[model samples]
Target: MHKAGIPLPNDQVNADDVKAVQAMSEKLWKMDLAEQRVALAVLISLCDCIVWWTQRHK
Candidate 1:
C-alpha cells in the first residue's frame, strides 16, 4: 500500500481510515483541473465544519 502512494495517518492511524483518505484523494485527482479545484474547496469546507464541531464539543 505504501508503494502505491497511499497515505497513512499518524501513529494512532487505522487501516480503514487510510484507505478512505486514499480513495477520496484518488477520486479528487481523477477529476479535471476545474472540477478538482471545486472538489478541494468542498473538502476544505467539510474540514472546517469538522474543526468547528470539535471546538464546540470542547
Candidate 2:
C-alpha cells in the first residue's frame, strides 16, 4: 500500500514521506506526454498553495 500524501493524524512526519513524494513525482515526469498531461491536471486540481523551484546547471 502507498502512504504518500497528507499529514498523519498522529502529527508525525518522516523523511520517507518526502522521499516517496519525490519518487512519485519523478516517476510521473518520466511518463508519456499524454499521461503526464493527465497527471498534471489531477495535480493542479489538488493544489492549494503551490511552490516550485528551479536550478540551472552550468
Candidate 3:
C-alpha cells in the first residue's frame, strides 16, 4: 500500500519480531483456556493503566 507515492514497509521483518513470534508460539498461544483467560485479564488491566497514564500526562 502507498500513500502520496510512499510505499508502506509492511513486508519488513527483524530478528526481534521473529523471536517474539517464537516465544508466543511456545507460550501464550499454547496456553490452556483458563490460563489464557487470566492472561487476557492481565493484558486488559495493563492496557487500561497505559491509557490512563497517557491521558493524565496529556
Candidate 4:
C-alpha cells in the first residue's frame, strides 16, 4: 500500500523552462557580432553576482 504522507512522482519536466532555454539559444545564434558581445557581457555579470551572493552566505 502507498504511504499517506509521501509525495507523488513528477513524470514530466516543465515546458516553460524548456521554451525559455530554447529561445535564449536561438537569440544567441541569431545575434550579430556586436549584440553577441553585449549578451556575453551581461551573462558574465549575472553569473558573477550569483557567485558572490552564494559565497557571502557561507
Candidate 5:
C-alpha cells in the first residue's frame, strides 16, 4: 500500500496493525476485481470512521 501511494495509519499504529495489513494485502491480491473493489470500499469506510473519530475526540 505504501508502494502504491496509499497512506497508512500513523498515530498509535502498532505491530498488530502492521501484521494485519500485510495479511490483508496478501489476501487482497488474490481477490477478483469485484471483490477487490468491495474490499477497498470497506477499507475506505474504515479510514473515514477513524478520521471522524479522531477529529471528534481532539
Candidate 6:
C-alpha cells in the first residue's frame, strides 16, 4: 500500500492511518466511566492544541 498522505481538515473520509485511534478506543472501552471521561478530555485538549497551532501559522 502507498504511504498515506496527510489528511486535510475537510478531506473526504477514508479508512487509513487509524490504528492508534483504534487502540485508544479499545482501551477506553475497557475503562470505567470516570476514566473514559478523563481520556475524552485529554483527546479534546489535543484537538484544541492542534487547532491553535494550525491557526497560528495561517
Task: Give the count of colliding residue pairs in each prediction.
Answer: 0, 0, 0, 0, 0, 0
lDDT of 4 by residue, 1-58 (tens): 0153322222344577887667656655665666566656766999999999999999
Name the candidate that leads on TM-score: 3
* lDDT by candidate, in order shown: 0.63, 0.51, 0.62, 0.62, 0.68, 0.59
TM-score of 2: 0.36
| RMSD in Å for all candidates | 10.6, 11.1, 15.2, 15.4, 10.4, 11.3
After superposing candidate 1 on the true structure, give the runs of residues whose Cα lies further than 4 Å from its correct spot: 1-27
lDDT by residue (1-53, candidate 2, tens digit) is: 02433222233345679876676666656656765566556678656224332
Model 5 poorest 10 in a row by lDDT? 5-14
**Model 5 TM-score on a 0 to 1 scale:** 0.52
What C-alpha lDDT does candidate 3 achieve relative to the native structure? 0.62
lDDT string for model 1 (1-58, tens) is 2353443322433567987767766765665676556655766999999999999999
How many residue pairs in model 3 have overlapping backbones?
0
Off by over 4 Å in 4: 1-27
RMSD of 4: 15.4
- Clashing residue pairs in candidate 4, if any? none
Cα error, residue 2 of model 6, in Å, equals 33
Q: Judged by lDDT relative to the true structure, which candidate is superior, 1 or 6?
A: 1
Best by lDDT: 5
Error of 5 at 57 (Å): 0.7
Candidate 4 TM-score, C-alpha based: 0.52
Candidate 4 lDDT for residue 19: 78
Model 1 C-alpha RMSD to native: 10.6
